[model samples]
Target: MLINDNQEQIAIATYGLTKIYERNIAVNEVDLQIKQGEVYGLIGPNGAGKTTLIRMLATAEEPTKGEIYLNGDRLLQDDTNPHLKQYLGYLPDDFPLYDDLNVIDYLDYFARLYKLSKPLRKQRLQEVLETVNLENKRNSPIATLSRGMKQRLSLARTIIHQPIILLLDEPVSGLDPIARLEFRQAIKLLQQAGMTILISSHVLSDLAELCTSIGIMELGCLVENSSLDNLYQKFSKQQILISTLGEYDKLEQQLKNCPLIEHWEKLSQKNHYLAHFTGNLEDASELLKQLIKADIPLHNFHCEKENLETIFLNLGHQQTS
Candidate 1:
């Protein structure tokens, strides 16, 4: 983690970032500040400039106009700063791997590219292998590894240099559920180890579960940027699901009398009811108490916060509106 004299821990910062290619403005003016050790999720539809923004941050491409600062040091336009290279790691959506090399050899190749010394390179290789849960397959040939294993190997290669910040683009694109879970766990471990990560994923549920904060981009513009909680509050409506024992009619009647509920509906001809509720948790609890006092015979009740997918769609609608 890096901190300046003001005691602010910022891992990456960009101001008025923009990218232009002939007639296309791939990325408009964007300002972002990511704190140290925060797992930030970048969400948006296809061709939303998510990849362009990531590429600029990774130093893989130059921004048309903007200032980029990593750990408080201004990045050069040429992006040839050797010192900055050690602080940033980038894993693109399609990671190229050497099928001929064994797992250890492949990782060793990248470590050498990073100019790590012999002892430190060997230690980092071991650490990264363990971090990605590939220690047992260190001797296995890359060609024989599964897709999930290959993805993990790519991540190991990215982190072998132990960079402080990582930029990942759709890392779990083609993985199965189990593979996605395993990869997510690996990312969480990296976050715990104090690496700030900016990851873009189409998997909204996964992002909701893993990211502490999120930024939503739309058509080369950043429309939303905030913590996950704040995003939910801004874009989600609070709802509650209630299931009654056998008294559906009674439950519906009692809930209709409650002032906290803005609207209520019986779901799909089922006995379960969902209500759009307005109020804090205490108010919700009081409503539950009222239902119990009225003998509504509740079997189950739970509050539902909007998921990432729902919030994303709402943002999309807002964009067009």
Candidate 2:
């Protein structure tokens, strides 16, 4: 279940959304709700059904049983509601590009396909090119661009029609560090544009930096879904780092004396230690006061929360065999 504000408008929702093959249930009954303008990250191990759920939402694949909604309107796979397609931009992991066409021409082609007026197409092409930082390569052939550029070009094509919601699957799969950083920047720009984006990626660190909320999948079931803040509050372990100029032994003894500290570890740096803190800010302050009273030359003291990756691994969700 998703922990969301009741007042927030839901841009995408699913009810009992499921998919099945001959013997395997690719996606179990999943009830998901994503608020408008939210960057919702989906993470899980291989064969966890993340792709299947995304495909169903993109209308590329039909669900065996379930209902999908956008802005409170039911979405049907049939062509009866063409307007619904206009509201969504779906980019699969393997996105095709016209290698022969120039960047501008390629975007123009998709814009025309979406029935954008010539004047509007011209305007939108420039906007998208700028958004993806591909303005310099507007006239460059798609085949000449690097892997990262190709991905950004594909993203530009996806948004050429100005879709309100975007569904992206493993957008940064095989790119190098620089390429991945570029892609992340483009996604941030899109988010600032107020597009509700659902992204699935194995890169938890990127998701940690990008997503407003996250949903974890395992064996076709959504086992966890919550806002980042809420997830941190509930699952993140707090630790305190203390750097002192005084004697290490004295600092260690002081930490051992504190009941609020579960345990402490000596760091590689001189006179620096990490303590597993179990109390609130007030308790931390009291501990700091005690250290000062003991004449420990404390130079730095601060709390560090567990990151998304640590919390995810600690949850013990494994990939399908």
Reference-based lDDT, each prediction: 0.90, 0.92
| lDDT, candidate 2, at 43 | 87
TM-score of model 2 vs. true structure: 0.88
> Model 1 scores what on Cα lDDT?
0.90
Candidate 2 Cα misplacement greater than 4 A, ranges: 1-5, 243-250, 266-272, 292-300, 317-321
Q: Cα lDDT for residue 180, model 2?
A: 92
- Candidate 1 segments exceeding 4 Å error: 1-6, 77-80, 233-236, 253-257, 293-297
Among all candidates shown, the one with the greatest lDDT: 2
Q: What does candidate 1's lDDT look like per residue over 260-296, in tens digits?
A: 7888998985878999888788888988898888787
Candidate 1, number of clashes: 0
TM-score of 1: 0.90
